[model samples]
Target: MAVSGGIAAYKSAELVRLLRKQGAKVRVVMTRSAMQFVSPLTFQALSGNPVHSELLDADEENSMGHINLVRWADVLVIAPATANTLAKCSHGLADDLLSTLYLAATCPVYVAPAMNQAMWHKTVTQENIQKLKSHGVIIIGPEQGDQACGETGFGRMSEPLAICNRLMDETPTRCLSGLKVLISAGPTREPLDPVRYITNRSSGKMGYALANAALKAGAKVTLVSGPVMLSPPVNADLISVETAAQMHAAIIGKAPAHDIYIGAAAVADYSPMITEQGKIKKQDDQTTLTLTLQKTRDILAEVAQLVNRPFTVGFAAETHDLEQYAKDKLTRKNLDMIAANWVGRDLGGFDSEQNALQVFWKNGQKNLAMTDKNQLAEQLISLIAERREYERGNKNTA
Candidate 1:
C-alpha cells in the first residue's frame, strides 16, 4: 500500500487493517508528505514491516530498493492519491518514492483518488485520470459524499472495506460463469416530429455498469442500448437502438437465448400516435397543441410471460411511493426481481453518478445503500446470482 498526502490518509489505517484481516501480507510505503497526516509507526506496526519513506536511504538504495520493491509486489494500491500524486503519475514524474515505484512497477496499479470536490472536478484532473486509465491503471473511486473539507461531492475515497475487498480479491466472484445475460439500457426516444423527440434523463450508467459487472462474472453479455454518450463495454455485444419499439424488438429476439434478462432502460411509456414527417411549423396564433399517445410495448412483461422465460429483472425509477410502486411492478410484470430507486433527488438515480436500490423479489427485499453505480451493479449482480442458484436448488429438491 502506498499512502499519499491527503486528509483521507487517515482512512488508510483502517484499510491496512482490513487488508491484513483478509490474510494479505502488507507492507507500508509512505510518501514524504504522507507522514504528516498519519505516523509511519502506525502503518509499520499494523503491517508488521518496515516503512519505506525515502528514495535516497543509503541502506535500501544500495540494495536497489525501488526495483526490488516493484518486483516483490503482486499489486500496488495507492489510497488517498491526492491531485498532486495523480498529476505526477500521469506525466510520469518519478521525483518521489511513490511516483518512482509507480513508474518502475510492473504489477497492476490501482489508484483511489481523494481531494476536495472542486479539485476532483477540474478539467485538468479529469484529463489526468483519463491518461492514467489509458495506461491500464485501475481507478477504484473518488466516490461522491461528505468530504473532510466540509463539502459534499465526488472527491472522497471509497470505504476501506471496498478497497480491501478488491485488494484481497474477495468480491466480484465469477459465480455467473456459463450464463448468458441480456440487458437493455438508456432512454429510448419517442419522436414527436422530424427534429424533436421525448426522452427521459436516463444516462445508461447503471445498465452499462451492470453489463460490465456481469461480464466480469464470466457471463456472456449482450447489451441493447438506447442513444447515449457512454461507450459500450468491450467484452459485451452492443446493439444500439433509438425508439422504445426498436429496443423491445431487439430484446424479444435475443431474450430466449439468454439465461438472464435485465430491463434497465427507461423506455418511454407513451409515444406519439401520429408522428409528423417534417418539423411542425409554428402557427401564427396557436396557444396549445396536443398529440394523441399510444402505449409502447411492455418488454419486461412480455419476456416474463414467455413459455420458456429467463430469470427476468426490471428497473423502476419512481418519484414517490418508491417501495409500493416497485413491488407492484414486480407482481404486475411477473418478474423474478425488480430494482427500484427514487429519481429526481439530489443523492442518486436518473443521470447521477451514484445510486441506491431497493431490490424486491416475491417475499423479500434488499436495500442497497448509495455508492458508485459500478459497485452497486456488482452487488446487485451477485445477489441475483445467489437468488437464481437458490431457486434452482429448490426445484431440484422438490
Candidate 2:
C-alpha cells in the first residue's frame, strides 16, 4: 500500500492493520510528505515488515527497491492518494519511491483519494482521475463527509473497514459483459423563469454510484445526467442536460440502444406553462403571484413502454405510504423492478451520503438496509444482473 501525504494518512494505519487481519502479507510504501503525518515505524509495527519510503538507499538488493517490490506484490493499493500523488502518477512522473513503484508494478491498482473538497472537484484533478481509470486502476471511495480541514464534502478517504472489504472481496465478475446499460441521475430543473427554476433535493449520488458499479461489473455504460456538482465517472458515455424536457429527450433518444435502463434521476413532475421573457418584475405592493403548471414527460414510463424495451428499473422517494406507493408505481408503469426509499427522515435520503432501499419486482422483494450509496449500488447492480439472467433463462426454457 502507498500512503500519500494528507491528514487522512493516519487512516492508512488502520487499513494496514485490517489487511494483516485478513491474512494477507502486507508491505507499505509512503511518500515523504506522508511520513510527516505518520511515522514509518507505526506502519512497520502493524504490517510486520519494514516500511519502504526511500527511492535510493545504499542498503540492499542493489538499490533497486522499486523493481523488487513490484515483483513481490500481487496488488498495489494507494490510500490517501493526494492530488499531487495522483497528478504525478497520471502523468508518469516517477521521481519518488511510490510514484516509481507505480510505474514498475504489474499488479492491479486501487486508489483512495483524499484532499479538500475543492481540490477534488477541480477539473484538472478529475481529469487525472479519468486517466488513471482508463489505465485500469480501480478507485475506492473518496467518500463525502467531514474533512480534517473543517469543511465537509467529498474528499475524505473511505473508512478502513470499507476499504478492506472491497479489497478482500473477489474480483468483480464480468456478469454484464457484452451488455449496454443506460442510467439517469440527479435532479432535473423545471424553469419558472430565466432566474428561477423548480427542482428536487436529489444529489445524484445514488445514480452516480450505480453508474460506477455498472462499469465495474463489465457493462458498457451511458449516463444521462441532470445538472449535478459531482464529476462524471471515467469511460462512461455522458450526456448532460438540465431541464426536464431536455433530460427526457436525451434518455428517450438513447434508451433503445441500451439493454438495461435505470430511471434513477429525480425529474420534475411539472414545469411552468409559460416562461417569462425576463425575470418577473417585483413590486412593493405585490403580495402573491401565481403561475400555471403543466405535467412534464414521464421518462421512466415511456421507456418501459418502448417496443421490446430494455429491462427497466425505477426509483421512488416518498415520505408516506412508501410500500403502497412503490408497488403502485411498479405496476402502473409496468416496470420490471423498483427500488423505493423514505425521504424527509433524518437518515438515508436526498443530499445525504447514505441511503437504504426496499426493492420490489413483480413477485418478490428485498430490503437493502441503509449503507453507503456506493455499497448499495453494488448490491442493486448484482440483483439487476441476476434478474435479467433469470428472465432470459425462463424465455429459453419456454
Candidate 3:
C-alpha cells in the first residue's frame, strides 16, 4: 500500500520491490498530488499490480470502482501520506476513494507521513495524525533527516523498503507478542577438551528466520546462537553458545517460562561419551579405537512438558519418509506445530536461501512452497496468529 503526494513517493517503488521480494503481495494507491512526481506505470511495473490513481474513471466507476478495491487488502499502507490526504482521513471526509477506504477499512492501515518539516510540525497536521491513530491507523516513521526540499528536518517519508520492513518486523499481532520466545540457531561445536571438537551442517538460516519472523510478529525473542557467522536478528536477546553443553545450559536456564519454544537448531544428536582430555597423537598405520556416542538432552520435549508450558513449535529435517518422520516427531515432542523439510533436495536445506516446508498441526496442514525464507516466515506468522486465535476460541467455549 502506498500513497503519493511527496518527493518521498519515489522511494515507494523500492519498498514495493522489497515487499514483493519477501513474498508479500503489494497493491498501490496514489493520491492525485503524487502523480506530479512519478507516473503510475513506474509503480505498476514494480508492484506487478495495476497502479490505482483515480477515484473516478469512466472505465472504473461504471464498475463501482474504488469500493471494489476497498475490501481487498491484508493491510493498507500509505507512503507520503500528504497533509491533504491525512486531513481528509483524520476528519472522516470520504470525498475521495482513498479517504473513503480509510473510513471503510476493516484491516490495519499504516501511513508513512512525508511533507515539509514545517508542515509536519503544524498543530493541524499533528492533531489529524493523533486523530487517525486514535481511530486505529498505524503511523510508521517519518524519520528526520535530509528532504527533497532545500532544507531538511522531520517529514521525510521513510524509504519504501523501510516501511515494509517495519510492518513485517514490528506490527503487533501478538501471535508471539507479550510472550517470551526462546529459539536456537546454527550448529554448536562439541569440544573434546580445548583442542578438539565436532559440529554439524546447520546454517541457522531457518532458525534465524523463525526468530526474525517471530519477533516481527511481536514476540520477545531470545536467540541462543552457535558459532556461525550469522548475525542475530535486531532486538533479539542473543546468547552466543559454543558447544552442546553450553546450549543445553542456556536452554535449561531460559526455556522454563517461555511462551513459545522453537527448537530449530540442528543440535548434534550424539556426543562423544569419552572425550580425551587433550589432542590425540598421530598413531601408527593400523589402529582402532572405541568411542561411545551419547544422546544430548531433548530440548523441545523438555520445554513442552514444563509446568506452565507455552505453545511449542518444532522442526524436522528429513532425507526420506518426510511425512512419516515429521508426523512422528510432532506427536513425540508434543509440538503444537511442526515445520518439516527435506535436506537432500536442490533447495539445499542447510544453507539455501529458498526452501519449502510442510507445516502440520493436529488436523490441518499447509505447504510452504519454494520461496525466500522471509516470505515463508510471513505466511507462517499469519498462520500462527490464526491458530492461536482458533485455539483460544475453542478453550473459551469449552
The best candidate in terms of TM-score: 2
lDDT (10s digit) by residue, model 1, range 313-364: 9999988999999999999999999999998878698878789999999999
Give TM per candidate: 0.68, 0.69, 0.59
Candidate 3 residue lDDT tens string, 1-398: 75657888788878888999989888888877777888888889988888876677668746555667766776777777888888988877887667776766655568889888999999999998866654446688788998777877998888766787888975556466577888888898877656877788888877777776776566888999888766556568999998787898898788877767778888888888878877777678848856677888887787778777767788899999999999998898888888899997776588776778899999889999987665566577677667767877998999
**Alpha-carbon local distance difference test for all models:** 0.88, 0.90, 0.78
Q: Give the TM-score of candidate 3.
A: 0.59
Off by over 4 Å in 2: 1-76, 79-166
lDDT per residue as tens, model 2, 1-398: 99999999999999999999999899999988999999999999999999999988668669898888987987799998999999999888999999999987655578999999999999999999876764557789799998888899999999999999999994466678889999999999888788998898899988988887787787999999999887677568999999999998998999998999999999999999999879998889989999899999899999999996999999999999999999999999999999999999886889886899999998999999998787788789999999989988998999
Off by over 4 Å in 1: 1-109, 112-122, 127-166
Clashes of each: 0, 0, 3
Error of 3 at 89 (Å): 34
The parts of candidate 3 lying over 4 Å away from their true place are 1-174
Higher-ranked by lDDT: 1 or 3: 1
Candidate 3: the clashing residue pairs are 15-160, 15-161, 169-216
Estimate the Cα RMSD of every predicted model relative to the unseen true structure.
8.0, 8.6, 15.5
